[model samples]
Target: MAPLTSASDENTHQTLLNTLDIYSAPKPFRNASWKPPQRRNKNTKAILADAARKESSQVTTANSGTSTPAADTAPPNIAQAAQRLDRLVLEKSLIAPGPAVTYTNIEAAPSLRPERTRHYCDVTGLVAPYTDPKTRLRYHNVEVFNLIRTMGSAATEGYLEARGAHTVLK
Candidate 1:
């Protein structure tokens, strides 16, 4: 008879036991389900507000000897919140300048990165790799290039001037 030298035989049974969802408690441990709780996307602030309102309404009704269900109020949607933010900004501006080093939508924007300087097709506004030497208009493909060539010189100059690349000094 040969003694077992393999560790696999000992590990397999223990791993299987750990993986199983045992329904009954054996001795020391209490009966428990290890399954994860279900997930739900909920507005917790509105929930708490509803609960508070319910308690207050219940108290008032009990005192008056009348029973009434508390109406549940839903939280404001994104648009309403945005409008509120805009109003706050307007009010703040009217009152006084904000604290020092304050950053707003139009003010205190970060500078553009030189490494992220990407050209786009003037015609289609897509990522452009090819640049026409005549008008210096960025293009995505040969089709766009042909379109530029057919365009009048004034239009060609317009595209170049718009992008701050002047071919004809005008």
Candidate 2:
């Protein structure tokens, strides 16, 4: 039998090209089903601020308050525990200082549904580099998601503070 040659590969190449032309025309725009930012009620904000303040104060007092002479002798143990707790609070404080607040978002998997193609952003439809037959313009879902996630991560403090307050209520 003859070894497979690059010339023979042309047939597969042509077949892929034929298949690609069907998708070459950009997919129609689909309304991106992203959720909008939620509006916080003033009362809710006040309540949350109060709760977070209360919880942190309570935690500080309970963790720091002690009236035992033994506590002075075994100060290392208390100090170690206090140091760990302080470290944790400091870490959380960093997150709580972020500027932008986060709201939950639910995304549907992008799938080929011919009827729904016209509403979404065209950029979402582009195939990844390796998958495309040509090396031209390619759009990666991961890249887009990463960009968005980075923006969200930058707002970590606001997101955590709101989430923290909510968690305390629960």
Predictions: Cα RMSD each = 16.7, 28.9
Measured with C-alpha atoms, the lDDT of residue 92 in candidate 2 is: 56
Question: For model 2, how does the per-residue alpha-carbon lDDT over 2-64 read when each residue is reduced to its tens digit?
Answer: 324455576776776777696677656765786777986576457656766776676556655
Residue-pair clashes per candidate: 0, 12
Q: Relative to the true structure, how large is the alpha-carbon lDDT of every model? A: 0.67, 0.48
Error of 1 at 115 (Å): 4.9
lDDT of 1 at 14: 65
Candidate 1 whole-model C-alpha lDDT, 0 to 1 = 0.67
Cα displacement (Å) at residue 131, model 2: 24
Reference-based lDDT, residue 22, model 1: 73
TM-score of each: 0.34, 0.20
lDDT of 1 at 111: 68
The parts of candidate 1 lying over 4 Å away from their true place are: 1-106, 109-115, 167-170
The window of 10 residues in a row where model 1 has the poorest summed lDDT is 65-74
TM-score of 1: 0.34
TM-score of 2: 0.20
